[model samples]
Structures are given as C-alpha cells and as structure tokens.
Target: MNRFMQALGLSGNSGRGKAELGRMAGASLQETAALYPFALLAAVYVLGTSPLGLLLLAGGFHYAGTLAGDRQSRAGGSRLLLPALTAAAMAAGILAFGLRPAGAAGAAALLAAAVRGLITGRKRLWTGVQIPLPLWGIALSVILYVYIAGSNPPALTPHRTELYVLCMTNLFVLLLRWNTDQVRSASPSYEVDGQTASRIAAVNRRLTWLTLIPIVLIGAWQGFGPLLLRLARWLISLLQSSSIPAEPPKQEESLAAAELRHMAKEEIGGTPLWLTILGYTLLALLSAVIAAGVAVLLYKLLSKWLPERLRLWVRGLLQRFRRLRAIRRAPGEQAEYLDEVERIEGVPPKRWRRRRPDGKRQYAGDDPRQAYRQLIARAMKRGFVFRTSRTPSENGTELETGGRYTDYSPEEVRQLIARYNEDRYGRR
Candidate 1:
C-alpha cells in the first residue's frame, strides 16, 4: 500500500510539471504578440504624409520586427529581412489607402489585411499586421482636421505624436528582450570552440560594412546636402529674375540693352553656392589636418625630450600591449601553452638538478638527461642510481671526445669527462 501511494505521488508531480511548462510557453507567445494593433495604427498614419517621419517610423518598426523575428521559433531568413519586408508593406498600404477617398480607403485597407493574412498566414500576419492602427488614428485626426475641422489646413502635416509613440513602443520591445537569456547565449563566444571564432570574426567584419555604409552616407549628406539645396534655390531665383520684364531708364536707348546690363549684373553679383561651400569645407578640413599634424609633432618632441627611464617605461608598456594583442588574436592551444609557460617558474637547461647532503639517493652527473631524470625523481620522491666513471680518457681526459655520451658540445663533454676522471682517478 505504501509503495503504491508513493508511485501515485510521483506521477501527479510529473503531470503538474508538464502542465506548468505548457502554460509558460503559451504566456511567452502571447507576450510576443500583444503589440500588433498599435503597430498597425502607426503604419497607416505616417507614410506618404510625412517623409522624414515615415522614415523614423519605418526604422523603429524594422528594429522591432528584427528583434521579434530573431526571437521567433522559425528564423527562416536573415534577421533584418522580416523587419524590412514589414516596413515595405506598411509603406505600400499607406500609399495605397491614404491617397484614396476615405470610404474607398477603408474597404481597401480591410481587403489588404485579408489578403495579407491569407498570403502570409495568421502567424506572419500578426507578425506584420499590427503596424496600421496607430497610423490610422493619426491619419484620421489629420484627415478630419483637413476636411472638416479647419477652414484651410496646411497641405504638409505630420503625425508627430503617433511617430513618437511608435518609436517608444519599439524601443521598449528591444529593451524588454535585451536582458533575455537567449540574447546572452547568442553573444559572440569569448572562449570559442571549433571554427566558431573565425566565423564570428567574419560576421563582425561583414557587420562593420553595415556601419561603414551609413557613415559614408552621413558624411556625404553633412558635407553636400545643404550645398545642393542652396544651388537649387539659386537656380530657381535666376530663372524667376530672367522671366521678369525690366523697366527701361529714360536715357537708355533700347530694352535689349537694359536686359543685357541686367544679365551682366546678375552674373557678376551671383556667387556660386557650391564653390563657397566647397571652399569652407576645404578650409575646415585643412584646419583639422593641421591640428592633427601639430599634435603628432608635439607628441614626437615630447617623446624625444622625455627622461631615459620614462622612455624605457613607455617602450615596455608598448611591448606589453603588443604581446597582449597578439595573445588576444592568436588561436588554439598555442596560447594556453604560452600562458602556462609564463605562469611556471623557470628551470634553466644547465642547473636542472639538486641533491640533499645526506644523499640517500644520488645524481650521476650534471648532464641534462641525467639532471632531468634526477629532477623528475626528486619531484616524484623516487630513488635513482648514480654512476661514476673511470678510464681517464672516458671519465675526464681530453681524449674522451669519442665516448658514447658525446652528444654534448666537445668543450662541454671535455669538461664533464674531466670531472669524471678527477673523481675516479683521484680514488685510484
């Protein structure tokens, strides 16, 4: 009876554990899902109406979509592709619906949602479906103000509030998952295994290209966007002035003469905006270059004048830094072996053995092979035989060079043979 009761208890515990696991999985899916409606609204309100605002909204969605796609069970594509596709769909929907009559647009939106749902299925629909709601809310407010509430609403308007909300929602989602165990697990491995380290390095190099493109774009825009805009404005002004009829002075002979003078004046007075900006940019770049050159020169001078001890310290520090970088860059067991060698005490080749005066166990001689064996025995607390040689030539004489133990340099062998002969022949 006791055994049966114990088995029954164990079975109940196992069943409860499975039930709890199922509940947690369901909750996590729901949490991943809860933000779709708001995303849908944001999408509808922003695109086509506010160009920059639309871009910001798209960026936020792309970020959130990327995070979501990465977290999803089926990561079938690149982490960035899903988010990008979702943004594209949102943009398309806004352009399609926002430009149409309100009633017609509503039907179109419902149709689009249905079609999208069918094409991508319920999971992917929810994946991209939530972006239109906040967009709709902002669009509704704008459409109402433009058509009904105002006498003359501005043609250019942006749903700044909804854009802000969309950005915040995405930032929050990213932050929420930032602390997840999965993110920690996916981080580049520090103590990598197999080819994983090289793969990670390659991935990082590729991702660096992602950053480089944005940097180049920003650099060009900062250096040239304003210049181009100014040039366009100036060209428009020139055309406008050319189209205007100029009044002739009473003393002037002809209208053509007055027009030609006006043309010449305009030409003389008009500064090339591009050239002006280019000059300033060049000046700024030159100043930066000169400052950098001066700094480098000062550093060289200071290094030259520094105390010898200080220079040595700096050189040592630089070498240590280089060694550290090499260690960081090297692969495999070579690094570990170097680290072990650094940690252990030095045992020079020559002074490899020692013995106690009591001499319970003895060392034959200081030949490295014998010394190494002695050292090992001493380390392991084992006993070993000590052999002494005689035969003045074999032991310590100059002619002992051809002995079987003559692998050592002739001078070293001679020295060892001399010691052997001294000890053996002295007793003889």
Candidate 2:
C-alpha cells in the first residue's frame, strides 16, 4: 500500500510530486485565464445544447495541438505541421461520421487542398495556417453536432442558438489570439531592466482589458439579444445561395410559381442574399473600427487618470489571478545570468562595485572616461562590434546607426553616446 501510494505521488516526503503538482496547477490556472471567455461561452453552450462530451473532446484535441505547436515554436522548429495534421484528422473524422460518405470525402479533399495551399510557399504563411486550426476544429465539431441533430426527420430545423454561440465564441477567440500574438511579437526576447519590463507589462495589461470589453459585449448579446443568431442565419443563407445549382428553373413553371418559390426560399432561410452579404460586411467593418476606438480611448483615459499606486495594485492582482509568478523564472536565476554576462564582457558588477554618496558607482580612478569604456565593452557583448582605430564618438555613432540593439530606443542610444562623448572629450 505504501509503495502504491508512492507510485501515485500521494506519499509523504515526495518533493518531486509536490513540484509536479504545483506546475500542473499553475499551467491550469494560466490556461483558464487565457481562455476564460471561451470557457464561459462553452458553459453557456453546454448548458443549452447538452453536447458536453463532444465539446470536451474537440477542446481537448485543440488544446493538445496548440500546446504542441507552441513547444515547437519555442524550440525554433517547424510549428504548424503537427497542429495542421491533428486538426485535419479530427475534422475528417467528425465529418465522416456526421455527413454522407460522398460529402465527407469531398469536405476532406477541400480541407486538404486548403491546408496545402496555406503551408506550401512561405514561412510567413505557416503561422497564418496554424492559427486557424483550432477554430476550424471547433467549427467542424459544431457542424457535426448540428448534422446529427438534424438527422431526425422531426428535428430537421437546425439549432440556431448553438450556431450563434459557436460563431460568437469563435470570433472572440480569434480576436483574443490575434491580440496575444501581437503583444508577444512586440515584446523583446532578451532580458530588460526593471522599468522597461514594468512598462511592457502595463501595456500588455491595458491591451488585455481592452480585448475583454468586446467579449463582454458579445456575452451580453448572447444573453439578451438575437443579434448573433440573426447574423448567423444571414451568413448561412448567403453561403447556401452562393452554392446554389447553376441550372435555371424549368420553362413550364409559371412566373408567379417561380417568384413564390424564390420568396419562400428567402423566408425559410433568413434574408435576401445580396442584402445579407452587404449587411454583414458593413457590420464587421463598423465593429472593428468601434472596438479600436474604444480601446484607444480607454487606454488614454486610464493613463491620464489612474494613480501609479492603484495601477500597480491592479497589475499585481491580475498577475496573481493568472498565476504568472508561478510560471516565471526565479529572480535569482535572472540576476545571476545578467551578472555572469556582465563579468564576461569585462563590465564591473553592480553588486560588488563601490558606490559614491550620490548612489552612483565610483570608478577605480574616479574618471567617467573609464566608466564609458566599460559601458562600450558591455555594448560590444550585446552585438555592437567596435573598431580599434575608431574614436569613442565614432564607435558610439556606428553602434547607434547599426540598429543592433532592438530593445533600446533610438533616442536612448543617442543620449548614451552623447553622454559618453561629453565625459570622454568635452568639458566636464
């Protein structure tokens, strides 16, 4: 019994088990926070639709694929192929089960062609292909459910509510993913000073709050209005019309009969084809513009009115809520790494160096020129190559113009060079 308990990680003195549990808990919380909007939508959907098992299965596959892709990306390997294969396989399986054999084969062929087209040419296209895999998987799962439900002759009419929820949730997830990717790409990969990291975190938090507003609005619409339902219906009708048979009606059919048939089709569907397409196009554009404006205005207002202390508190709360600290590397590791890098570059260590009364580090000879040389050496370690014959000002200018340091601003580089020149050759 004791051995079994130990194997199950329930035994006392199991530090490894405890650490693994902590990691799992932290990952779970982070994922929950990241997908909170989708979770709420899923809950609403499951409560109304009663397709919990299918939804869970689809979500599980999607999460697994996404995690695989992210792992590959971090390792600087091909990131999209595995996700694409997983998503496509899941979609094909769902379609095969829910559709006629001919229809399933046709859809699978179409999906294969689309995936190939997306991933064939450029590296940039791989990312575009990978991002939509989860949404496509979820959409296919929903389609399978709707098809199954409609298989019953008495229940031929599709469930509009489930479709609406899927559309809204998919849109929200897409937006959230896009915003996250943008923020992540904008962030510097190298370690930064505390002030820079804090500023970046603040910007990310603000963007996150802005992104949530639209999702909240979507949730409200789901609860109180039929906007999403109507939109879904219109979109479905437009697609159906576009795929209509090219052959014309029989000449024997009376004009009134043909007109009545067309009207009946439109009524049964949702809206006239042209009007539906136009309305949705305009609606999408307007929503995008409004969301952008709202985000900008909210950011401006908060920056102007919110106190720093309150802002810090809010940031801290958000970090704790998301379990970010649990996932972040230890501060000691980061400090040690930075110190080691500085030592390798022949720069004085901040910790062991003597400090003046003004809190500035005192150089060995009490000369700012030597301090400037150390700073130049540090810059060299950061990829700023210096020529032995070049003067300090020339070296600084070359470094500034080279655009090697992606994390530093142009003005910051200019200012640093100016200070170095002033200390080295100008009146002090």
lDDT values of the candidates? Answer: 0.42, 0.48
For model 2, residues 268-358, the per-residue Cα lDDT tens digits are 8664567667767766776677688866644543443578987787667765654444345546534222111113235457744555556
Q: State TM-scores per candidate.
A: 0.21, 0.28
- Please give the lDDT score at residue 423 for candidate 1: 52
Cα RMSD to native, each candidate?
22.8, 21.6
Q: Candidate 1 lDDT, tens digit per residue, 1-428?
A: 33432332212333333432232332232222233333334334432233333333333333344334333434344445444554455565555446455424433333333333223321433222232333344344444434422343333223333333333343233222322322224555633452565455456546545644553464345323355556555655565566556664768468888788879988886655665565556556755775786565445435645799988987888778876776798685554323111122466765544645565435455543343333333433332222222233333332233333323455654554455435544532
Deviation in Å, model 1, residue 120 alpha carbon: 7.2
Highest-lDDT candidate: 2
